[model samples]
Target: MDPLPFLLQPPVFYPIIPYACTIFGGLRPGRMILIQGSAGISATRFQIDFQCGCSTRPRSDIAFHFNPRFSSSDAHVICNTLRKDHWLDELKFSGAPLKKGETFVLLFLFLPDKVKVSIGGHHFLDFTYRLPLKDVDAVGLYGDVTIKELSFLSSNPLKSGSADLQKTPLSKTFPMGLSECQVIAVRGLVTANPDELTLQLKSSDSIPFKLTANFQDQTLSYNSFISQSWGQPQNVQTPFFLFYPERFFEILLLPEAGLFKLAINGTPVNDYRPLVFDLKSIEELQITGSAGLFVVQC
Candidate 1:
């Protein structure tokens, strides 16, 4: 929520073409690689490689090879692995979102089993690893692309070694209580047939705010529990549904100026003014739902 920390390495700006650099901490789940650049007007193809090492004569292994090919009629992306100078089966994704001469922001989100790719802040495609992810130690970018910036974002702070969000009903306590300008981020994956998901900010004797995302009814509502009674529930009027089965999601709640601002997947949703006046009275955060959580950052 707070401008993702660059824990691995400092960002590189305006690097020369055919650049290759060591990945300080290697690849890990929850880490993200962000690239901002544009293709040349006559660009045909460019490749981004996650390699074991930078070897020339012997050619080090490539764990993931992401190649985007541009053409006059159609565009496509090819994903594969290179082991011992031999490429594995290539996976082709048609209708690539990339275009020659167009600037774009690319994001690669590393997960346990697959890598999620986003182009220009929109989900594009996924590439599963053929080689072990832990072996990837360097990254290489080649061909007719001008890179503006490149960075590696830190993984979830709450994550432990080989530990993911499998336990439910997760809760976190704030010793000094919450204050204004603080943000809470919750990221997870919706179950295939999720019914409902609830996130709450609780005080000693009451719930200052509770959000319920009902997938069954396709609605999002919020309320407060105070004085042994539940307040009137209010529905959030969103332009479109934000949650989907088998999809990843991020929820950000920021308390500011006597109200809470909410956002879903980088898009602002709505603000809600709570019944509780004392923001510092909120001491706990709780999440319970049918989704599989990846991280909860306060």
Candidate 2:
């Protein structure tokens, strides 16, 4: 194979200041290029070392040469050498383990003097240099890694609200209880139907309070609302309030009549930005039983 090209004279300087950062240039797996010998940039020995010229090195620099074919096990990693002649004595930095077919997310947080690297929610490293790190600078990556999104978060980040939100279904059933009157709020579609819903409310007692609404007359009608005590079911359209531990239950409403806002259990959501669809239209509605069994798996 032909020898890799080299710069004639490499300077010695650091490209980053104490807190500045450069976001990765498109170095994701899709646009990854195998690196060999002194990745084009002149090596700076200190902060003030200017780029002398394109220079080649025999030992102090890293080679980006890849095998003729792709191999996950043989990819290059980021390394730091003490001297230009001691490549074998280099120190390698490993980020999170790169698994084949696994997609990764990279975030660069630039502070006044340092840069923080976050990979898949796991913090990788903080880079501090003697000079300013320019944008679109090349970092390091290897095999079996796919980049999903490369983002630069300023003081005000630009991202969807759902990016950091996660929801997990309740695994255990909750006992019967009443909700505080202050909790009910109306937003999306709410209706009266027992056949299409199963709710488990818990109070101070160990037994979960069970209530199911059956839609008989094409509308879901229920006079009973959850409270702290084993109270009497009253005839009311809105939720009545009482002190309770917390309300824990799952409801599956029809596609047309969406999720009932649990904020207060009554009038429609009005405080903040509303979602386009309160309840997603799914084929099945599922809930776990008290014993952790699939109680209502639709």
Which one wins on lDDT? 1
Model 2, 79-123: lDDT tens per residue? 232234343333334434333343333444545555454444456
Extract clashing residue pairs from model 1: none
Residue 283 accuracy (lDDT) in model 1: 88
Q: Give candidate 1 regions above 4 Å deviation.
A: 1-3, 6-162
Task: Give the local distance difference test score of model 1.
Answer: 0.82
What TM-score fits each model? Answer: 0.54, 0.24
Model 2: lDDT to the true structure: 0.26
Overall lDDT per candidate, in order of appearance? 0.82, 0.26
